[model samples]
Target: MCVVHLLDNPDSWAPASLQGLNLCGECNDQMIADLRLVAARWDDAQEALHAGAGGGGSERHAQRIEAPVPINVSVSDALLVARDNIWSVVLRLVDDHAVQLPVYQDTGSLAEWLSRSQAVKIAGSADKTFTKNAYWWIRDAAGWTVTATHGAETKVDLPDQFCKRPGCNAQLVVVENRAGAHIVQCSADAGHTVQWDTWTNMLKSLGAQKRRGPRLSKKRA
Candidate 1:
């Protein structure tokens, strides 16, 4: 992870979040890339600081500073949050930390927000899809079976080595199906069931995929 010195005052910051935008039709890959570049630069700066430097001047002192994580500031807090129907990012500058700012971008439509939220949820599901909490089903010679769900579910079959959850461990097998939903029996019993939000989020994500796959939106202004 990159590191940077945080200014003592939280008020100082550049535009950190995207702002003044409607439902974006696509994603902003360039924006993402730019963010990554910025992160890399910060990482370089931190590395340079870690390497002992001869006593320079105020600039060196400033470079030596490190920023605290989960930084609280009025600067815009950029995010890649998904709403569902429309995907967008924001660069809004927070005026005050006390004010409860909107976590997601304001698209001026609740329906739009709901859709975007659903899409975002689904996108998140696609990340660790093999995990038990994710919506994972298998349709072999038997029939359509759910491998994992909210409660204790099981799968039946011996595929030697297969993923129990849709996207958790890649090395697991369907032990047995107690009910309609298939149960996931993994070699690594990582104590942690699929989170409720993750399950529902997967549904929303799948729904979004049915509509639009990955997209990109850029700042024209």
Candidate 2:
């Protein structure tokens, strides 16, 4: 049985109650609830695949692996649950769990990337890194730098707004703009740039609980 605990200050986005309590805090509870729902669907899909594997042929096995998981998620809910900080954490966790789809990496060209991400929407500023969906929402809100390499020339260009080096306060100056991909130099050393999916996976691994209670009622079973 799913338990719903209402927050004293209602965050409509969060679950009424969560699986545990130790980690329940101010803003992230809603994200935890959303994760639970999504995870439950994934588990159910896996179970169905297992159920269909009795004496199955190779074709059946292949189908199970390739078929889309039957998850009935609402886009609106997904958006609402994925608030500012909450969205980042969930997206990071998803990425960590290797659940991301194929999308272009940050190649320094927000416009070109936005063209590829037509299916998704970008909502926030380009200057500010947003979570999975949000990051794609407002592609041009903040200008990014482009670094490309031509046959013999290295070209770099900057958008109105550029990414600041990870630690250092210096702006990311674009040095090249190639047709396909580009590279830029920053004051700080290069760091691993994680995709939104990878970030979502990290949140899942947090192992934090928003609330706690018996998973099911003895009589319900």
Candidate 3:
């Protein structure tokens, strides 16, 4: 049977919760090895980040001059990034080899093919989620600033406020801005400006949580 292994670490592969597929022993071993390789790559990348952070040198100086210093991310974060990247390549492979292989056929051969493929080197979509220019820590300014590359660059001046709207619990952005003034109207929607406060007290009040209805007892007929 095809066994789903949890790709959480590099040492050993654990059986996943769901199970149902006919996979040979060799194929299963190949799948586990491929997953371990991916995990290893992620670990190496994280280690590189940590290694770069050590000591006084050109690299350290450069990092200091750079607005946001890149730090080593967690394994879970790396796993997520690897997962997305791997899936994208897998989907493309499936599309290209549609004629030869069935979509739901044994993934062991497919997994082996993927292991030797160049697509494994591709960076995940989440890799760009936190680019160097996206946001920065300004030591002199004493706060973080969104760079021009960020979608919210224009709204950077807006106070960090949460939406107070009952059902629409999305973050509220500054809809109206008064030049050279602290006063502004904030809302997720331009028309839904139900609350108004100074920039200082904008996030003072918290949004009310929605209460769940009581569970109904089973009727014994």
Candidate 4:
């Protein structure tokens, strides 16, 4: 039996695994390659978005100018974008009769799934279901691969140093509200504050911090 690997869900291998598709090795390889192409396209879109958001510039500029604005996309919204991107490629393949696979029962099922908060299981697949905004689908050697791209869970701890504002040496404190929004503020003053509207935004900003290397002066005579 061939195996289908979900790109997003790396941990639960068995759950996304399927069998009895009987696809030939060459056909399976081609399908997997197609799926990877789709993933690459999705990644390229993400990179483009980030670049538009000023992610490709020098570290100093990224920190000074781009740090304030958060991407502000909900997990569900992100998943929708991924689904749309993937479907664009998948639909073409289906139209061309490029590969044989199970027909999707409901054409609008993805939209329905996006609208609802509950998890919905994919048809004819065991131990696999769409939960959160991370779920995705791809054709492979086995049968189908169910995947997810929800942002990884993160733990927020106070930074040792406070205030990114120049000349401020004060310590920082992490303040969170009932809605899960957090702000890192300088204990010395509230004016020097960074607000994170969502946990994902917070994590993104933290992860996007640019590191600087020490500079050496020339010793020319």
Say which candidate scores most in TM-score.
4
lDDT for each candidate structure: 0.25, 0.27, 0.29, 0.34
Candidate 3 TM-score over all chains jointly = 0.20
The 10-residue segment of model 2 with minimum total lDDT is: 140-149
So what's the TM-score on candidate 2? 0.20
lDDT at residue 117 of model 1 (Cα atoms): 35
Q: Model 3 over residues 20-107: C-alpha lDDT tens digits?
A: 2223344334434644344333323333334344432121211222235454332222223333434444564455444244353222
By lDDT rank, best first, the candidates go 4, 3, 2, 1
Off by over 4 Å in 1: 1-152, 155-157, 162-171, 175-179, 183-185, 190-221
- Model 1 scores what on Cα lDDT? 0.25
Residues 1-221 of candidate 1 have per-residue lDDT tens digits of 00001112233332222222211222222222323333223222222322343322221212223544322110111110111111222211112112233454322232233223332332232222221111111011011112111113343333443333555555443433234433233445422123222233433444445444432221111
TM-score of each: 0.19, 0.20, 0.20, 0.22
* Clash tally, candidates in order: 43, 42, 1, 1
lDDT of 2 by residue, 95-165 (tens): 54434533532211222333344212222222213322333222111111111002222423333323443
What are the C-alpha RMSDs, in order, of all predicted structures?
Answer: 22.1, 21.5, 20.3, 18.3
Relative to the unseen true structure, what is the Cα RMSD of model 3?
20.3
**Winner on TM-score (1 vs 2):** 2
Q: Please give the lDDT score at residue 85 for candidate 2.
A: 24
